[model samples]
Target: MSSIRLFILSSFDLLGPMHGHRLRIEAENRHVSLWTEISVGAVYGAMARLAEEGYLRQIGEEKDGKRPVKQIFEITEEGRRLLAELRRSGLTEIWYKHDPFDLALVRLDPASAAELPALLQARLKALEERLAEADRINAWAAPYIGVTKRAALKHGQHRLRGEIAYLREVLDDIDAIVAEVAAGKV
Candidate 1:
């Protein structure tokens, strides 16, 4: 199963029966987008797909005055079993052999070398911005989350800092390469 499905199932397990809207709100309240690729807009579609798959079923409908009726969904026995299996086995698995930057770097040519510094600088800027956001998340989440969770956030920030440092070194190397090419020495 995809991580998104697993996350949605886990959400139902944590929050109990909820409509799509409530699930989206819960995801936002938990700041899921800060850590995962899942978006708030994807929740409703995932709910529909899971419902169609029999993993989730409509328990009832809720109407909030002027708003349209909302379908309440709950996890089924199959879903519970799958969730347990995923938790037991999936939690131990790690996959990290994917990075767009790796591909770009591999394909870079001397003719296009001038663009590398700018691209790397842009990525450095973005990573720095993400580090700032992580700080904001840490400040707010520290009071509400446990020590282990706070550590996980710090871990991400630490990893970003390391990447930023490495990228700076690479930019320095690129500067040397640019100068050498300009002087026809490379």
Candidate 2:
């Protein structure tokens, strides 16, 4: 239903038509980085959306006494098709995929010394936008802080800080490279 459909289905593809608890565990086992709190809501929403789109079908019963029933899901034929397409679609050649990081490095191969500064500037601008977005999310989640935030505020802040640091390091590296290239060193 959304861009996250791939992750949602892949999570299911790995776990099989399991209910929430099982899927959560499987996602964690597969990617310890996934916080169940954040991922559960996302995966659940994605699953429901996919079901409405006929990409998935209920497969089993999961009644837990007084707790809400969890409906198991199975990949529909359409889901399989969609998954395959998502997996291989980048290869068709009509248009090549250019992820942000790839594009940054790819352009470095042919860019002139003058162009390097501008390109690095553009990349830094993009990084700034991302950091700004992360900051906004962290700020909004501040009220929930450690308790109600699905992901801990500290964790989110730390993750954002890591990203910011990585971006800054890249920026520094590019600046040094540009200086070297301008001086006929690299």
On TM-score, the candidate that comes out on top is: 1
lDDT of 2 by residue, 1-186 (tens): 233576666666766787766765655654424322345446677778889998888988899899988888988889888877765652342432445865555445434766766766776677677667767766665664456454534555565566567766766787677777666654
The residue-by-residue lDDT of candidate 1 on 1-186, one tens digit each, is 366677889999988999999988888887777666688789889889989989899999999999999999999988888788777765577746577876766566567777778888899999999999999989988999988778768878888898899888878788776666555554
The parts of candidate 2 lying over 4 Å away from their true place are: 1-3, 32-40, 90-186
Model 2 steric clash pairs = none
Give the clash count for each candidate: 0, 0
- Which residue segments of model 1 deviate by more than 4 Å? 175-186
Full-model lDDT, candidate 2: 0.64
Q: Quote model 1's TM-score.
A: 0.84
- What is candidate 1's local distance difference test score? 0.82
**TM-score of each predicted structure versus truth:** 0.84, 0.45
The number of the candidate with the highest lDDT is 1
RMSD of 2: 11.1
